[model samples]
Target: MKMKKILWFSILSLLLVIATGCEKEKRAKTKEEQIFPHNLEFAVFELTTHQACKVACGENGEILISLQDVKDDVDTNCSLAQFDSIQMMEQIKIYAYLNINGDSTRLEVPSKPCGTVSYYCKDKSEEVQDVFRLIDEIRDAPAAQGDSAWFFDTFERLFGKGASIDHTPYRIYLAKADPTKFDAPHARLEDYRLIFILTTK
Candidate 1:
């Protein structure tokens, strides 16, 4: 009977030790390293002829722009058409949690004048010149993750009227809908935001 007591005590002690070790391991983990509610943020800009409209992410991590008279389509071949006929442009900013699974945030702004492939139809020679000029401007801006080449390609495809877009260098991350679960494919992008920072300068 004494031996049985001793054996039971030993087993209980072993289980206690294993439980303590697991708790220690969990304490050593960091919340930042784990997927959570506040991991990432984003900002957006739109350049119009008269003034620029800016939107900053607030509590819900969203911003909306209201325009008086919005035109969906304009002449792609005319340089002045982009400015003369168009009434307004909208910009939106976003803030989100960066997670291991997929990208959660979004930017749905249409490709604007500067990043378009046609360069306002200013002839091939002048178009290249304008593109280079815009690229230089982006290089002069401040951004944590920006690239001129990304901007050039994004605009070329988006404004070039259904031109093929190469999404190889781009990456996507999903939102943490449930902290206990991780997903990868839930995140998506309407347009590339890399160019905004690349050509920000």
Candidate 2:
């Protein structure tokens, strides 16, 4: 009788453990599916600014934007703007708006050129020539210091001298829909737009 009771207790304990393990696994799988549905990876976009000019000049510099995939689990309620990153799952399209003399004009910036090159002038470890080589391929004019330089210079060359340098230049907008589906001018998605107040020296 004693042996039978001990055996029954052991079996019950084993069943409880198995049940708990299965429950935990089910919960984890549900959470994982919620975060990365359809086996698609999610990425966070970052805009890193490098000061090309002296400290006294303020925020006058180059902007290197990068998109990195998120490895860790994220909160379900968290939005892309909350992390100061663009959400890739929504097919976000970035638009460049150049503000000249209180007038805003949308520039024809190809999506391919937008994130191709990210370089820092001060980073001595990276080959300077290699950086210039990459920039030269994408840019219309000669490679100027970095990406921001190329951007501002290109516009100025097209419009007129001092078109960007004389004033606060452009604003970057991120639309949450497909590039082809939505008209950037009509969309009122200001919450996702990041206004980069870039100036040239």
lDDT of each: 0.32, 0.33
**Model 1 bad stretches (over 4 Å):** 30-38, 44-51, 56-201
lDDT at 195 for candidate 1?
21
Regions more than 4 Å wrong, model 2? 37-95, 98-201
* Tens digits of per-residue lDDT for model 2, 20-108: 99999999877756543123211212221221222123335443332111111111222323434444422332333332233334232
Error of 2 at 94 (Å): 8.9
Tens digits of per-residue lDDT for model 1, 140-162? 44431234345445434333321
Q: List TM-scores for all candidates, in order.
A: 0.26, 0.25
What is candidate 1's TM-score against the reference?
A: 0.26
